[model samples]
Target: MEQAEAQAELRRRALDYHAQSPAGKLSVIPSKPCKSQDDLSLAYTPGVAAPVREIAADPEKAYDYTGKGNLVAVVSNGTAVLGLGNVGTLAGKPVMEGKALLFKHFADINAFDIEVQARDAEHLIDVVAAIAPGFGGINLEDIAAPMCFQVEEALQKMLDIPVFHDDQHGTAVIVAAALQNALELQGKVFKGVKVAIVGAGAAGLAIAKMLRALGVEAVYLSDVHGVLHAGRSDLTHWHQPFATAPAHWTLMDMLADADAVIGVSVRGAIPEAALSGLAAKPVIFALANPDPEIDPVAVKRLRPDAIMATGRSDMPNQVNNVLGFPFLFRGALDCRASQINQEMLLAAVDALARLAREPVPEEVQQAYGFSGTDGLSFGPEYFIPKPLDPRLRQWVAGAVSAAARKSGVSRL
Candidate 1:
């Protein structure tokens, strides 16, 4: 679709969507038989007592006795939705509802959207922490950057169940998977890659830390005001640990000889001039949603040998968080993880990247209706599996669950 046409079409769809009103994506339905008096008695009064008694005797059995095990909650304050930014708690409903549907569809996990109107992070954290016991896991979604970091940290520190901010780790996982694949494809070593992370928000910071963990030699993280140097006195408390040395190498210097650049920043953060000095076979992920920091086409034009990826599904080599969130949550919830730590996140990345390395299959290709599935050449674009691919849930879940077990954080 052309730009003008796409905009008009989007507006039209938005109007139609609002017209249709509530009753949004899904509704809760009873799973047990409820046809007669015997059924009602069994499902509610007499039979329910048996499961309740068992669960009371052994608390862990609540997972088996109730839907608590496989069910997660997508909790948000609507303080930030996409780039729309601060749309209010109630306005964030549609996005949360959509996420719940994706969780159910991708992982056989039941997710409910909880939108609360809290005065601040402390208020929201207290409320969510109080309610956290009911959920097996919590997905903190589409909340703004620094605030998101604080909220997730507070909740994870306070709660027993896994609390994940998909914007941070989900995006980080997929980017890591794609970066691994891209580097492999180009015969590049991750160890020596001078990486530049543009956007010191949740996703960017997470990516930076993960890359550092994976051995990227050194990475210079930058936000709008420029490089996050050790001497940057204006750094927030949330961004402090990342304040490292060698402050002389600014973003300009860092990007001058960088091998990989991950842009989660605002539009057009990387000027064409900066692209000129990047190392050959540059693995650049301009992963800003809706619109990437630089158009992949533009990046290709400026740096012909560069490998490009984005957050948009319409484009080839899309580096989307959808590739990781459902499966990661599946594994974490199943393992009864106390929190989604670095180990579990890295494991998911490894599995996802490994899956990308295999030859694409016929059925998987058929699923996309794109003809790459029958042991076809699956490359960069296919690195991360689509959320609806039906296979990654178990694959990713197994990796995370195993990691959680290994990390000694698994209740299972």
Candidate 2:
């Protein structure tokens, strides 16, 4: 009864929080002053024409005259919202607005949340490509898997600006970074560890690709049906590369002897029995939100030696995508990158790993409501840096920008 009342209170507070404002979470405010007649003229009609003409002559001048360099379009089709599943495009506006808020709050990037009524991947691709010129970068969000892969790929090829799917690569980057640090603490090497991922959706597939880039050869992926083995006829192209050869391998078989397990699937997706087969000092990231694959408390009881992370803020080592997307786009937009490539993503991963090892700043400690850096050190409990760490803006973003320049992807 108490739990139910608590949940009801939370629901009421959330609704009130969103409803109390200007009806929604976002607003368009003029960046320039327009109090006087001359200011108005410069802001719009006559004086604006000068810069307009320059922009017309050279499209690159849009960055000089307008807010184009710092603008990002947070595009979503509402096909797959992590916890909510397929909430319609209109229904997904709040989540996108929250993402925009994160961009502004964390990295000072201006983001416009665009909810597109796209019928499929092709439609979303077309809509985003059409509006690509207005944004410095496109942040693909909440679109379902299989389709998300298609949409992101098409937009990346069709548009010159950075087109990133946050559900995929953003989650992948943070997970990779956290896992890298976790592995280092556990005395495991990236190339030597065997990882079993329990979801073959956008996050899972992307995590697999990211880990592969970091030099892990033994990656096993599974969907709802079972482990994605070579004999699975229903496997998509995205799932095939990560498939194991043995046809009859189950989730238990995949978990057996694995050094790490990452769950991007729904709650209760992983059975408690599966933990019995894991290698010693296992690294487990139960990233299913609201509820994890298995309870962290349960994991603690069952395997005291395990290092665990979850998507919940209440948990230590929360594998939050907030740590990745804001600074990533900040760097890409600052550099005017042609696209967000593998090198940039790896740079973010590397930056995050190194940042975790450094001492937590006093500002960061206070931001997370911590009194001091007692538990927030470079250890199993805090392998990933807190999302509120201000250093992330400079460290991760700068590394990404430098890599973009080095990789010859930067237009700046």
Candidate 3:
């Protein structure tokens, strides 16, 4: 098939797949039997009243009495639906449902995708806060930036449960992990390297902060205008911390001789000419979905020694958020964590990085259709573990739970 035909076919199949299954992707099934009057009594009404009274008295007993311990609310306003922006709440339902599916499939966690029709940031925050008592954690998804930051911060302050904006921290955790392995493969040290992060939105800002916490020497951030420099009038409060020194530096200037270039921006944002100026054996993570900041193939052609990754599944070393959020929330919910903090995120990053260095299992190799007798292992093409690697639930969740406990955030 031609490229356009292939794309058209994919669109048709995706819509059919979603439409074929009970009209949508998710449905609530009772965990307890409701087949008989005896079971019904225990599941609701008189017997259920006992647990309700206990929870009313103690509050903490709700975790034991209800699904509150295992349930996550995947809340969003539908302002930013992947590459398609501001498609409205109803249009964004499918993506949110997909997230819920991932939660159940990947980590055995139950999720209710809540698409809130709030008027503004504060309204969305209020809505999430009001409904937060029913969930163990809140996975904020697809809300636009600035507002996303506001909503997350407000919700985190008001609610005791883990409130995570996956667009920001989820992408950050996976990227940090992959970068750790990528740098190691190139014999580069994090503390000595200068990093350039294109697209200073939620993901870019979060990644820069995470890398700084991991002891990277300096991180230069850029948006549509160019490199974020001090005194730029367009800089929001969130962008101020990432602002570089007052210099007339373009995105190309920031990329010049940089040890690593992380792209969370739109397609073709990084020109071909810029790739040639990168440091020897540079790590390039062109992580924009569907289309990346720079084409991976073009990057390889321009600089043969460069280590490359994209958000596309077909590409090698894909920095996917699915690798982080499900298991991260699983650990947070398991330990009754109050918040998913930076410490927990870093723990997840560490687990992912370590897991990449270990010998890959046969199941993982088969999942990705790798037929090599040597088995799947860490290299330029395989810096991070595949999303289907079953071990992620164990390693990431364990590490996150441990970090939560150590950070004094875990109620367990």
Candidate 4:
């Protein structure tokens, strides 16, 4: 098949898959009987008043009387979908459903994706904020940056329930984990490390913020135009935070002598020149999907001591959000988190890092179709744990719940 034909065929199959299962995921079921008059009264009428009154008397009792405690709404405007860019509201549904599926499968949490048909960021945030009272937590996904920052900040400040953007923080959590492991393997530290982050978009910005949160001594970022630096007249509001000594820096300048390079930009931005002069045994997470900024093979060939990770499944050390999200919300819902704070994000990152450091089971290797010969090492090719590692759910969830409790955000 020609390239266009193959692409068309794949799209056709994806549509077929969705059409085969109409109405998307999540269907409400009547747990109480409606077959008899007495059942009707108890389930929907006068008899329901007792529990309703009790719950009204004590807000905390809502967890026992309703699904309020175990449910999450994955809210998004669909301004960003995959790497497809802004495809609008209707186009993002399947991805939302996929999020719902992962939530159920990975953590047994009841999640529904709420797609706001609003044409602007304000409308989406308003809709989510108005409905926030009904859910235990909100998981924001696939919205673009700058605007996403505004929406998350607004919702977090106003809503009592936890609000999170999986793209920003989910990617951050895994990268943090991989970096922690990679650093340990290299006998290096996070502070005093020169970090180059390619891509000024949501994931890139979030990863930078998280690295700063985790105590990175120095940081740099590059957009399509080049590096984000101090007083760069062309820099956007989001890019200003990572600005360095100069007004602007080229991609190669940013990468030279860097201890770590995080590629959240498009494919092939970092040619071999940019990869040169990286610190010995450099940690590289080429996170661009489908194709990373640097070819992994070329990277390893050029720098034998370098550690390599990407967002691709075929590569070792895949830092997929599948490593998180499912279990991250599980903890928030279980704890009845009133808001997703920096505490929750940090907790997930630490838990994920530690979990990635654990020994991989033989079955886990078998599931990945590996020969089971690779020792459990948290380094270049082994920085992240396999998706099938069973302990992920408990480890991530427990830490989030603990953070929620300690942070005074947990109702449980």
What tens digits encode model 3's per-residue C-alpha lDDT throughout 32-88?
889999998998888989998999999999998899999999998999999899999
Point out where model 4 deviates above 4 Å. Answer: 1-13, 23-26, 29-39, 234-237, 371-377
Give every collision pair in model 4. Answer: 160-338
Predictions in order: lDDT: 0.82, 0.91, 0.92, 0.82
State the lDDT of candidate 4 residue by residue for 1-412, as single tens digits: 5978987997898778777755566666665669999988988779889888998899878788878787889887888898888898788988998888878777877788888887677888889989977777888998987789889988888888778888998898899878878877888888888888888888988888999999996888888876777767886677777777465456777888888999887788777876668888799888887779888889888988888888988788899998878777788877777876788888888888887767777777778776555655555578777777888888888998899899998876
TM-scores for every candidate against the unseen true structure: 0.93, 0.98, 0.98, 0.92
Candidate 3 weakest lDDT stretch, 10 residues: 244-253
Prediction 2 global C-alpha lDDT: 0.91
What lDDT, from 0 to 1, does candidate 1 have? 0.82
Residue-level lDDT for 230 in candidate 4:
77
Q: Model 2: per-residue lDDT, tens digit, 1-412?
A: 9989988998999999999858778888899999999999988998999999999999999999999899999999888976898999999999999999999999999999999998777878888999999889999999998999999998898888999999999999999999999988888989989999989999999999999999999999988999888888898898888887488887888889889999999999878887777999999999998889988888898988899999999878999999999999999988999999999999999999999999888887777767663636789888999988889999999999999999999998
Q: Candidate 3 lDDT (Cα, whole model)?
A: 0.92
Tens-place lDDT per residue, model 1, 1-412, is 5998998998898768756845687679887879999998988997789998998899888888888888899988997787677999888998899899888877878989999898888888888898877789999987886778888888888888889999888988898888988888777878978788888888888888788789886777888877887788899876777766367766677688888899988788876678888988888888777888877778878887888788787777778677788889889888788888999999999998887666665676676666733433556555566655556776788999999999999987
> Which residue segments of model 1 deviate by more than 4 Å?
14-22, 245-251, 372-376
